[model samples]
Target: MADLVTEIRERALALGFDAFGIAPAEARPDLGDKLAAALAAGWHGDMDWMAETAERRASPKALWPEARSIIMLGINYGPDSDPMAMLARKSTGNISVYARNRDYHDIIKGRLKEVAGLLSRRTGAEVKVFVDTAPVMEKPLAQAAGLGWQGKHTVLVSRQFGSWLFLGAIFTLAELPVSEPMAESCGSCRRCLDICPTNAFPAPFQLDARRCLAYLNIEHKGPIPAEFRKAMGNRIYGCDDCLAVCPWNKFASETREAKLFAREDLREPPLSELLALDDAGFRALFAGSPIKRIGHGRFLRNALIAAGNSGDAALLPAVEARLGDGDPLVRGAAVWALAQLADGERVRRGAEAHAGGERDADVKAEWAAVLPEVV
Candidate 1:
C-alpha cells in the first residue's frame, strides 16, 4: 500500500500537481455541525445550493458510500504581480487572481480523472472525481489530507503554496495510507481579515459570504447591495484583497502552468472597454474564461458598479448608454452609476428620457432614489 501511494504521488507531480495527500473518506465528521451553523446564520447569503446540498456535502462517505480514501491535489495559481495593487487603478476593473486565466475547472478536471484512472488500475478500486462545482467541502478535506490548514480567513493556507492553491479531490474505494493533518499556523496574523473591503469575516476561521465581494460580484444574481458599492471599488468580477495579503505567500512562486497565468487582456481590462461589451462582444472576449459564466447582464451590472466608484467623470457617456439596457438589473445599476458621475440636472434628463417607460419596480425605484425631486 505504501509503495502504491508513492507511485500515485509521483504520477500526480509529473502531471503538474504541486501538492498531494490522502485522507480517510470520513476524516472530517465535524463538517456537518459546522455547515449547519453557517447555514443557520444565513452567512451563505444568496448561495442557496450550499444549504440544499448540505447532507451530501457534509462527508465524502455520504457523497459516495463505496469510497474509503480520498486524494486531495492542488495546483498553485499564484500571481506574478500583486493583485492588491490593481485595486488602485480605478479606471480599470480588478478581477480576482483565480478568474484571470482559463477556468480552473476546465484545467483541473481532466488531470483529476487521469490520476483517478491510475489509482483504479493499480488497486482495482472504483473512483470518482470532483472540482469546485461539487459540494465536496474541499478546503477542510485538503486540510485533513495535509495539503494545508484552514487559515484564519477560512481559506486553506499552505506553508509552500500559501492561499494560491486550486484544489481538486478524487475518491476511491482503496484504503490508501492517510497523510498527517496540518496544524493551524496563522499566529496573530490578521492581515486577511483586516484587508477585506466589506468585513466578510465574522471571526477567525469564519466567513460570512454575504459580506464577501467575491460572492457579491460572482455568485450573486442581483444588483450588489448598496452599502458594499463604494467598497466594491473597481472590482467588477471578484476581489482578491484577503488572498493576496497572506504572509504565507512569501514562500510561493508564480504558477508553472501556462494555462493558469492571467491573460494579457484580463489582467486590468479598462472599464471603458468592458462597459462597451455587448452580449456578442462579451462572449467573444471571454470565450474560454470563467467570467463568461456570469452572463452579459450580470457582467454589465458589475462593471456599472465599478464605474460608479471610479470617480472618473469621463465614464459619464458610457454610464448613460446603459440606462436603456434590456436587463433592468443593468439599467438600475446604470442609474446609480450615472448619479455618481453626473449632476442632478443630467440625472433628471436621463430619468425623463428613460424612467417613464420603465416597468420594473427595481429600475423605477432606482430612478426615484436618484431623482427624488422629480418623483
Candidate 2:
C-alpha cells in the first residue's frame, strides 16, 4: 500500500501537482462547530450555498460512506510579480492574481481527473474527484492529509508553497495509509490581518465575509453597501492584498503552468476600456476567464465604484452614460460615481434627468443620499 501511494505521488508530480497526501475519510466533528459559528455570525454574506450544503461539507463520511481514504492534491499558481503593485495605478483595475488568466476550475479539473484515472487503474480502487465547485471542506481535508496548515487568513499555508496553491481532492474506497497532519506554523504574525483594506478579519483564523472586498466584488449582487465602496479602492474583481503579504511566500515558486500565468490584457486592464463594455463586449473580453461568471451587470457595477474613486473627471462621461443602463444595478452604481466626479450642479442635473425614469428604490436612494454628503 505504501509503495503504491509513493508511485501515485511521483505520478502526481509528473502531471504538475506540487503537493499530495492522503488521510482517513471519517466524520470531522470540529468542522460542524466552526461552520455553525461562521453562519450564525452571518459572516458568509450572500453566499447562502454555504448554509444550504452545510451537512455534506461538514462530514466526509456523509458525502461518501463508501470511501475509506481521501487524497488531497495541490497545484501552485504563484504570481510572477506582486499583485499589490496594480493598486498604485488607480486608473486601471486590480483583479486578483488567480483570475488574471484562465479559470483554474477548468485547468485543475482536467489534471485531477488524469491523476485519479492513473491511481484507479494501478490499484483497482474505485475513486471520485472534486475541485472547488463542490460542497467539500477542502482546506481542512488538505491539512489532515499533511499538505499544509490553515492560516489565520483561512487559506491553506504551505511551508514550501505558501498561500498560492489551488487544492483538489480525490476519494477512494481503498484504505490507503494516512499521512501525518501538518501543524500550524503561523507564530504570532498578524500581517494578513493588518493589511486588509476592509478589516474583514474578526479574529485570527476567522473571517467576516460580509466585510470582505472579494465577497462584495464577486459573490455580491446589486449596488454595494455604501460604507464599503470607498474602502474598496480601485479593485474591480477579487482582492489579493491578504494573500500577497504572507511571509511564507518567500519560499514559493512561480507556476509552471502557462495557462495559469497572468494574461497581459487582464493584468491591470484600463478602467476606461472596461467601462465601455456592453454585455457582448464583456463576454468577448472574458470569454475563457473566470470573471465571466459574474456577468456584465455586476462587472459594470464594480467598474463604476472604481470610477467613483478614480477622481479622474474624465470618467464622468462614462458614468453619465451608464445612468440609463438597462440593469438597475448598473444605474445605482453610476449615480454614486457621477456624484463623486460631477460638480454639484451637474450631479443635480443628472438626478433630474435619470431619477425621473428610475423606478428602483435603491437607485432613487443613491440620488437622495448624495445630497447630504455633496450638496
Candidate 3:
C-alpha cells in the first residue's frame, strides 16, 4: 500500500499536478468548531447549503466512512498577463482569470478520474473522485494532506504555485500514509483585504458572500444590491481584485494547459457588444464554459450593471432595448442603466414611454422616480 501511494504521487507529478499529498479520511477535530463559529456569526449569507450541511462538510468520515485515504491534487492555471490590467478600461467587462477559459471543473475532473482509476487498478480498491462539485471539504483535506495552507482568502495557497492552482481530490478505500500539514504562511499580510473593491472580506480569512461580486453576478437570483452595483464597475462576471493583489502570485507561472489560458474574446469584451447578446447568442458564445450555466438573463443583469458603471452614453441604446425584458431582474437592471445614461427630461420621457403596460412593480417605481423634472 505504501509503495502504491509513492507510485501515485510520482504519476500525479508526471501528469502535471503541481503538488500532491495524502490524508486519512477521518475528519479534522477542529473543523466542527471552525464551522460552528463561521455559521454562528452569520458569515455565510444566502449560501444556505453550507449551513445546512455543516456536519457533513466538517468531517470526511461523516460524508463517507468507508474512505480511508484522500489523494489531493493541485493544477496551476495562472495567466501570462496581469489580471488587474483590464480594470482600467471601464467600458470593457472584466471576467475573472479562472472563468476566462474552459471550466476547471471539467478539466480537473477528467484528470482526477484518470488518476483515481490508476490507483484503483494498482491497489484493487474502490475510489471516488471530486473537484469542487461534491460535499467534500477539499480545502481542509488538502491542508491536512500538506499540499498547502489555507490563506487569509480562505483558499489553499502554496509557496510554489501561490493561489493560482485549482484543487481536486480522490477518496479511496485503500489506506495511504499521511503527510505532515503545511504551516500558514500569510503572516501579517493584508494585501488581499486592503484591495477588495467592495470590502467583501470583513476580516482576514472570512468572506461575506452577499457583498462578493462573484456571488452577486453568479449565485444571486434577484436584483443586485444598489450599494454594490456601482462598485461592481465593469466586472460583468467575477471579481479578481482580491486574488490579483496577492503578493504570492508574483511567483506563479503561466498555465501550460492551453485550454485554461485566457481567450481574447473574454479578456476585455466590449460592454456594448455583450449587452446585445440574446439567449441563443449567449449560449453559443459561452459554450463549454462555466459562464454558460448562469444563462443570458442573469448574465445580462450583471452586464447592465456594468453598462451603468461605464458612464458611456454609447451603451444607452443597448440598455434601452432591454427595458421590457420579460424577466423583472433584467427590467430592473435596465432601469438602473438608463438612469445612469439619461438626465431629468429624457429619463422622464423614457420612463413614460415604457410605463404604459409595465407589470413589474419594481420597474414601474423606478420609472416613476426618474420622471423628467424629478432628477
Candidate 4:
C-alpha cells in the first residue's frame, strides 16, 4: 500500500499536478464548530448553500463513510502575464487569471479521472473524482493531506505553488497512508486584507462573499448593488485583488498547461466589445469557458458596470442600446452606467423613450431617480 501510494504520487506529478497528497477519510472533528462560528458571524454572506451544507462540509466521513481515503491534487494555473496590468487599461474589462481561458473545473476533472483510473487499476479501488463541485471540504482535506494550509484569504496557499493552484480530490475505497498536514506559514501578513477594494474580508481566514466582486459578478443572480459598481472597476468577470496581492506569489511559476493560459482575446477585452455581445454572440465568443455559464444577460450586466466605472463616454451608445433590453437586470445596469457618465440629459431622454414601455419596477425606479439630481 505504501509503494502504491508512492507510485500514485509520482504519476500525479508526472501528469502535471504541482502538489499531491493522501488522507484518511475522517472528519476534522473541530472544523464543524469552526464552521458553525463562521456562519454565526455572518461571514458567508448570501452563499447560503455553504451554511446549509455545513455538516457535510465539515466532515468527509459524514459525506461518504465508505470512502477510506482521499487523494488531493493541486494544478498550477499561473499566468505568465501580470494579472494586475489590465487595470491600467480602464476601457478593457479585467478578468481574473483563472477565468481568462478554459475553465479549470473541466481541465482538472479530466486529469483527475485519468489518475483515479490508474489508482483503480492498481488497487482495484472504487473511485469518484471531484473538482470544486462537491460538498466535500477540499481545502481542509488538502491541508490535512500536506498540500498547503488555508491562507488568511481562505484559499489554500502552498510554498511551491502559491495560491495559483486549482484543487481537486479523488475519494477511494482503499485505505491509504495519510500525509502529515502542512503548518500555517502566514504568521502576521495582512496583504490580502489591505488589497481588497471592497474590503470583502471581515478578518483573516473569513470572507463576506456578498461584498466580494467574484461573488457579485459570478454567483449573484440579480442586479449588482450600486455601492460595489465603482469599486468593481473594470473587473467584468471576477476580482483577483486578494490573490494578486499575496507576496508568496513571487515564488510561483507560470503554468505550462496551454489550455489554462490566458487567451489573447480574453486577456483585456474591450468593455465595448463585451457590452455589444448578444446571447448568441456571447455563446460563440466564450465557448468552452466558464464565462459562458453566466449567459449573456448576466455577463452584459457586469460589462455595463465595468463600462460605468470606465468613465469613457465612448461606450455610451452601447450602454444606450440596452436601456430597453428585455432583461430588467441589464436595463438597470445600463441606467447606472449612464448615471456614472453623468450625461443626465442623454439618460433622461433615454428614460423618456422607454417610459411607458418599461415594465420592471426596479428599472423604472432607476429611470425615475435619473431625473432627480444627486444632492
* Best model number under lDDT: 1
Q: Rank the candidates by TM-score, best first.
A: 1, 2, 4, 3
Global Cα lDDT for candidate 1: 0.92
TM-score, predicted candidate 2 vs. hidden true structure: 0.96
Measured against the true structure, the TM-scores of the candidates, in listed sequence, are 0.98, 0.96, 0.94, 0.95
- Model 3 Cα lDDT, one tens digit per residue, 27-93: 4778878888988877777778888888888888777889899999998887778878887898898
Error of 2 at 210 (Å): 0.6
The global C-alpha lDDT for each of the candidates, from Candidate 1 onward, is 0.92, 0.89, 0.83, 0.85
Write candidate 4's Cα lDDT for 266-294 as tens digits.
98889989888888899999998999988
Counted clashes in each candidate structure: 0, 0, 1, 0
> Is 1 or 4 the stronger prediction by TM-score?
1
**Candidates' RMSD to native:** 1.2, 1.8, 2.0, 2.0
lDDT of 3: 0.83
Candidate 3 TM-score versus the reference: 0.94
Which whole-number lDDT from 0 to 100 does residue 206 have in model 4?
Answer: 88
The residue ranges of model 2 lying beyond 4 angstroms of the native Cα positions read 254-259, 372-375
The positional error of residue 351 in candidate 3, measured at the CA in angstroms, is 0.4
